[model samples]
Target: MKKFMLITCFIIGGFATAQAQQTSPVWPGCEDAEDVKACFNQKLAQHVRKNYEYPQSEDGEYIRGKVKISFTITEEGKAVVESVEGDKAEVNAAAKAMIQKIPDMEPGTLNGEPDDRNFTVPFNF
Candidate 1:
């Protein structure tokens, strides 16, 4: 939990370990948010909605599926996708792309030291 960026929306549900972390990431534009976790989720939702795009398959149909993405916020405060899992490779790739668009923020901390934080988000397309 010391280095986990847990969230509410599309979160890795049951990832209660984040509770042990010293501090959560200070999402960009959420520096003043009273509840860091809530703000993170809200901003994440907004980011997903703003960047959401459905990829087209070769068959001329939109790819529709769900993807689970694992990402890490590095000690340098940058979001990087760790992995993506989904039924369709295209959905997984698109989901990863959207997550990569997340802006950098103040890194989370553990034991008073900046640390890499991991977060999981799910996307339906």
Candidate 2:
């Protein structure tokens, strides 16, 4: 009976710890939001729409492509773009530049400690 009780306590404690560690980063102006993930996505989309600028084509033709960007939000709440993958050079460069301009956010926390969080965004233009 003692061993069974101990095992049950350990399982419950582990689940509590796991729940405490699962938290998402807060974006600027979304600090008070109840759902950080939804708020972050909405703000990110708005930021992209506000900052994105189409690259100038050398041949005066419209360029259309998709860019996949991966970046990390540092513990200090700054964005550092890691990679921008796209078929067009201009698109990749534009996506990277846009991501770099993201405003600082509240750092994510895991187990109540500030943690670096990675995010990926896809831009189609």
Off by over 4 Å in 1: 1-21
How well does candidate 2 match the true structure in TM-score terms? 0.83
Local distance difference test, per candidate? 0.86, 0.88
True-vs-predicted CA distance for residue 3, candidate 2, Å: 9.0
The per-residue C-alpha lDDT of model 1 at residue 114 equals 96
Taking all chains together, the TM-score of candidate 1 against the true structure is 0.79
* Model 1: how far residue 117 lies from native, Å: 0.9
CA deviation > 4 Å runs, candidate 2: 1-17
